[model samples]
Target: MEVKIRNRSRVMQVLALAMFLSLVWAYAQLEWGVPHTVKRNVLQSRGSILASDGSVLARSVGGQRVYPQGVLAGQVVGMMGETDGLEGLEAAYNRSLQAGENLKLTIDPKTQAAAEAALAQGVKEHHGEYGSVVIIETLTGRVLAAASYPPFDPNNWRNYSAETRRNRPFLDTYEPGSTIKGLIVAAALNEGLTTPTTTYSTPMERYVGGRWGSTIHDAVPHPPTLTTKEILRYSSNVGMSHVVENFAADKERAYLSNYGFGQDVQIPVVATATGRLQRPSEWTDLVRVTSAFGQGMSSTTLQLAAAYNTLANDGLYVSPRLVEGTPAGERREVIRPESARTIRGLLQAVIAEGISNAAGLKGYALAGKTGTSQVAVNGKYSDSLFDSVFAGFFPADAPRVTIAVTVHGATTNYHGSMLAAPIYKKIAASVISNWAAAPQQLPKP
Candidate 1:
């Protein structure tokens, strides 16, 4: 009986030891001893994204990715899936990020915050369906701020609509309306086809091509005749039609193409759209004329901002750079420096005495253009909805920054000067204060 009890106790002791060893082994596998594949499945560590000032935008916390400031750059920084990037800058630099490379963005936190605040306010006040703001360093082509409205938090991305997830400045395109007039005028001046003082018979409306073609009209009534500079100031579609009436279709396309249309503008972000511009072969007289004042074609806000930055950079077109390693694109002189200067002066006049006069800043020169384009829905244009836009460079005498603001789907009378220019002014003022970018004196002639 004693031997039997001792044997039973020994067996119980061995079973208990075996169970303890199994638990220990399972813990080891779960903690650190598992296969690499299994480990990868369980462990997720992503690199961090920092602003120019070293503030964290997105980072890994407790093995899970988190955006510290919630929606600081929700759409711009993009979101990540369990294993990899899904959109935005995260997707653009996915490989590097997955390899644990930390990224420092060109975005200025203060500038970005200011842009977002102003954009949100403008969109709400104007009852816009959506809005976007893009700011770029004129000389270096660095993207300082890219703000998209209908604020989203990546942490709860599923709750946000796809429209909010989209990076509007990079993906959305629209007929630029009169904002395009600046480029058209620049092209005309660059080609020596006309000067700022060149005069045209400025009717309110003019028919184009045959009856099949649409008639172009100015947004507001204008004088019977006006100079090129005055046409730009007033944002006259009819006057712009006259300015580009003699321009060949191929030349017009070439100029617009050189200004960064009809191509994907590469930044350090995955989402990009090559805005739709019809081929030269498809250009009818109406199409060509309408395109002169920003219709019958499309361009993203970023593309437009970069194109305008060309003028701010003395006619040098430099593609935007968002990542630290990527260099500013090669400089291509799209227009004569003199032509750019002339256009800048004309744009300044737009704020000084034109419809955008309210956009003027005290003690500082401002230059910009406003656009309000009708939106097309289901292959037909909608009369009730419009996209209002503004594009400009600040401290007009010495350009340091270029900005573009667009408010989409305005139900009310959508005038760029009314809906978009104020937003631009608000953001620009903040940017100027944030960077202390005030100019000392005008550059020498």
Candidate 2:
């Protein structure tokens, strides 16, 4: 009987040892291929994404899909870590992307390459705090090239500095400066409160009721009487407020809504931000005038690009989408078709004769805006420091791509035209050069 009990005990001991071994193996299964960076439940095999030339842009080689595009696609291809910031396309399309199945992205590799090169050059020349470039397909919402300075290399992701590695295009919000005035222009025209021909009497600055007067001024003043188009071209803060204030708060709010403010875009990465647009009920007079000119307002770079895409699509405002697979190719119209024409015409004039002239592409007609705003330091707008931004599209008559750039903590004048425009032009030129054939005439705004 004792001998029989000993045998049973030995069998139980073996079972316990087997269970412990299984638990250890299960824990190992959660680790990534990289020994040091053990992410939880990280798939050993993600999938394949091929470039236009059939070369692999990314794949599930050593477990997780490796981003060959490197820093160029960083923000869009965000890292899945313990902390969340610019969790770009990779995190966004993770489940849908798996081994065996391939994700055919719409991004043109040639364009992406160009964007990276141009941004690098710009950074080298300016050597600002940091910079970012985003190239988007106007017809489809595919993000072609999203590059940032002090870029993050996915190979050694943990080594990248947190601020330098962040995908600034979609994650960070800044004062959009005079760039947001485009929406005010659209709102005024849409509400029938003003027309392209509407006239505004300009003073360099005007008064608001608060301790901070509502008075608005120009980045550089020129004329006293100007048309709506001229006001936009000049990016006149007072002029923008003149038209915006003429309408009720409801009217202005409607325009911003149509422009996609207070909304997040659907992109691959989960790292996205919806810029804070004070609800009409929450707006004050002090906020109103500046908001018209993109001050007292905040926006992510992607949100700004989406708005410009409307003009690129001839007033068709499709919700921005980013994913891989066979999804619907249809677009929903957000603005009247003809309204697009009026805005594009004015925007074009700005590129031709306004402050953002440096952003003009060589062979293509480009339409875009430039903005420079004081980033709040010590609770006040500091002249010494500014955020520079350039947002626009190529072939103004019909745009295929939209490129937006932001330079943070620039030491130069930091105007959008002078700083950011050149980067967009370089990227556009590079993309156009590599196309197999001339693109079809894009839909005009």
Candidate 3:
């Protein structure tokens, strides 16, 4: 009878211990969330990233993340690491994605393909080290295409360098050169400082910061005087200097800020650059003159596109969006509607008569500006290296698409007109031909 009693006690103790262990496990779960093993299992079934048309850009298969679209939009869609995201949208929306929540993008596959093809071809043909192209819907500021090259294949991401994997449109910043001329001219019009017909003495080369200051030159040879429209057409740095001479340095900086310079472009990317813009207090005479003609400041390709979209959107600064259903960003007026329209007309003249004439399509009314800025090496600007850029909008009468293209370190044919403009033209043509509505007739010069 004593032996039987001892056995019963031992059984009771075993049951009590099991219950105690169960309670402790429950408490741990409630306090610290799911354990790592279970969490990893959940991550193995990570959600897909889809385009607006419901095509999968990224998905997990057999415990490995796969990019279905291959190199197309690879930088924007991004790839995964061993257990988490490594770059682009993957890194930006990691937690939600790991929870099996799908992320939809505003990207259009056709537009993205066009942009990638043209950018890759241009960069290769021009012998550029790298390049980026961005296309934003004019009214909504939705990013339709953001392409970078040399192309990255997330399926084989390990093969590419970090520079190749970088989203250059949002990350790389460079001096935008003459492309900023359009915005500067737009600001002058907005502030009632000048009209398109306003004339300035535009010598080919002239000392900008008084007689002792550095000299600025015009790339194209033109007559002694140029109207504001002609200044943009010829890309005359001297003429731009005169236009902004009386414009206060502080006001100029304000205008740049209004145009989205030196501001964080809050997109759902891992890391984005707020391009360098010096304070008004830092603007010396030389800085002001150079900044007027698109130097002494830096901007990303995406930022440049958004700035041009301001004019395209009738002076409204619709923040560029990448993800579908994301809250719209700042929507404010940067210029008067009339001023925006006037600037549009001026840019149209640029395609018709300016150095950017090569960017024009046969049947489409396009407005754009070309930029070729010297890349600064160490402390000084390099004579051999250049960043070629083009920014434009189509259907000039009522713009629908805005595009910005930049090619870095092109070894040959480095001019924006020769290299970047052709790339823009090809992408614009493809976009117009494939998905865009029939473009109206080209506007007369």
List TM-score per model, in order. 0.88, 0.82, 0.90
| Residue pairs whose backbone atoms clash in candidate 3 | none
TM-score of 3: 0.90
- For residues 126-145, what per-residue lDDT tens digits would candidate 1 score against the true structure? 78899998999999999998
What range of 10 consecutive residues in model 1 has the weakest lDDT sum?
436-445
Where in model 3 is the C-alpha error above 4 Å?
A: 1-40, 268-270, 355-357
Best candidate per TM-score, number? 3
Q: What's the residue-level lDDT of 418 in candidate 2?
A: 73
What are the per-residue Cα lDDT tens digits for candidate 2 across 43-123?
444556555445565555454546666665655555644322235555555565533356666556677678777877776
Instruction: Indicate the residue-level lDDT of 256 in model 3.
Output: 84
- Cα lDDT, model 3, residue 189: 95
Pairs of colliding residues, candidate 1: none
Sorted by lDDT (best first), the order is: 3, 1, 2
* Candidates ranked, most accurate by TM-score first: 3, 1, 2
List the global CA lDDT of all models.
0.85, 0.70, 0.89
Alpha-carbon runs more than 4 Å astray in model 1: 1-45, 210-212, 437-445
Whole-model lDDT, model 2: 0.70
Least lDDT summed over 10 consecutive residues: which range in candidate 3?
436-445
